[model samples]
Target: MPNYTLLTRQLEALLDDRDWLINAAQTCAFIMQQVPELNWAGFYLQRQPELLTLGPFQGKPACNPIPFSKGVCGGAARSRQTQRIDDVHAIADHIACDAASNSELVVPILRQGTLWGVLDLDSPRHGRFDEVDQAGIEALVEVFNARTDLPDFLSSH
Candidate 1:
């Protein structure tokens, strides 16, 4: 299991700035570097009322403009909860942005009480993300929520 406490601290330290995207970018890099077996780490901002557009990420190209009705990221955004898929192939509606990604974890990013977007992580290892990871990522998302300002980003979107 990852020492998420330490990771959260590291993220908080970097999040001193007011720019939300800067913080999001740093968080993506932090997750990709600190976490093992991760093929992708990123955020998907809510571009439309029912769609998510790719935001800051540290990986290969990803599926852009994902609707709120599809995939793990979509489900998390739609439900306002975390979605941790042990095996992406087993999920009928799984979006195959990267063929090598066999598992996924999507944590909704909320501003105040409204849905901001999601913090998404993908891995080539099936079952790579468990309860431990879900908890850690969720905690990290809280750190993100508390530190970053998203009013300008959200209003302009």
Candidate 2:
């Protein structure tokens, strides 16, 4: 099992010094390196209303921009919640940036109870992410929310 506590602590420290984009990218890369069975890990930012622009990511080059209601990343952003899909092929509106991706997890980054962006991860193995992974990633997002400065849309009252 991944030590989420330690991971969260590391993420908090990382975010304290780095800018959001670089911190997000490095954090995703760190998770991808530490975790097994993962094929892709990165972020999708809400650059505009109903649109998520690709952010720092580790893995194959992904689609540049994804709609807020489309893929797993989009669904999470739209719902402002974490989503864990055991099989991407079974999901409607699944965007196959990489056909090899079988499972996916997306955790929304919220600030002051507003959606900002998402932390996304993809795996080649079916059912690669579960409740434990969800909790871990959620913890990471919490660390992000607490440590990083929120974007104007998320921070504004």
Candidate 3:
């Protein structure tokens, strides 16, 4: 198992700036570089109500504009909860952005009680994440929230 304590500390140090976009992007790269067996690590920003648009990621291409009524990411966004799935194929509505991704972990990112986005991690190994990972990632997301000054309205222009 990876040392989440060290990882979170590294994340805190990596995020020197408060720019949401830059931090989000760096977080993805950090997770991808540090974590093992991961195929994808990224974010899906909820730019509109009940919708998730693609954000910074460290992986191949991905799906975009997911609705609240769809896949694992959607479930996390809609329910405002973290989702840890051991098998992606078992999910009826699993979004297959990468066929090699067998498992998934999605953590809901909130800003002052409002849904901001989700930090998504996909692994090629089955059951890649567990309770420890869940807790650690949640803590990392909290650090991100604390460090980032995410504005209420982010213009796409």
Candidate 4:
């Protein structure tokens, strides 16, 4: 596994840029490269009431706009909490962006105790993400939450 602290620092540095969208895209790409076995690593931004629009992502084309009540990402956004599924097939509303994706992890980014969006990742192997990954990613989202300059891409919702 990549050093989560190192990864966090790298992400922080990259996000320091003034262009928030570019920062988000670069962060997604960097994490995709640093982490192993991940099929997707990206953001699903809250676009409107009860909706999540796909933002920066590194993977096959995803469901462009996912309703907040739909898949694992939607569930996390709806509940405003981190969600991890060992087997995507077992989840009732799993959205198969890629048929090969067997596991998923989502961490909601909260600002002022409200759901902002989610950091979502998918893996080809079942049980690929565990508590450690959940914690690390959750911490990463918190880092983003602390930033005051996060772009309005999803904030406009």
Best by lDDT: 3
- Pitting candidate 1 against candidate 3, the one with the higher lDDT is 3
How high is the lDDT of residue 89 in model 4?
98
Question: What is the per-residue lDDT of model 4 for residues 1-157, given as tens digits with 9 covering 90 to 100?
Answer: 7678887887777677656577668768987998889999999887677889888899999987899879899899988878899999998888988999999999887766666678899999999988888888876766666643565444563
lDDT of each: 0.91, 0.83, 0.92, 0.82
Over 81-152, each residue of candidate 2 has an lDDT whose tens digit, in order, gives: 788999999999999999999999999887666667888899999999989889988888777666665565
Q: Return the lDDT, model 4, position 10.
A: 76
The positional error of residue 44 in candidate 2, measured at the CA in angstroms, is: 0.5
lDDT of 4: 0.82
lDDT of 3 by residue, 1-157 (tens): 8899999999999999999999999999999998889999999988887889999999999998899899999999989999999999999999999999999999999877889999999999999999999999999998898989886654553
Q: Report the number of the highest-TM-score candidate.
A: 3
Least accurate 10 contiguous residues by lDDT in model 1: 148-157
* Clashes within 3 Å, all models in order: 0, 0, 0, 0
lDDT for model 1 comes to 0.91
lDDT of 3 at 101: 95
Candidate 4, after superposition: displacement of residue 105 in Å? Answer: 0.5
Tell how far residue 109 is off in model 4, in angstroms. 1.0
Please provide TM-scores, in order, for all candidate models, with all chains considered together. 0.95, 0.90, 0.96, 0.91
Alpha carbon deviation, residue 2, candidate 3 (Å): 0.9
Q: Each prediction's Cα RMSD?
A: 1.3, 2.4, 1.6, 1.8
After superposition, which runs of candidate 4 have C-alpha atoms over 4 Å from their true positions?
151-157
For model 4, give the 10-residue run with minimal summed lDDT: 148-157
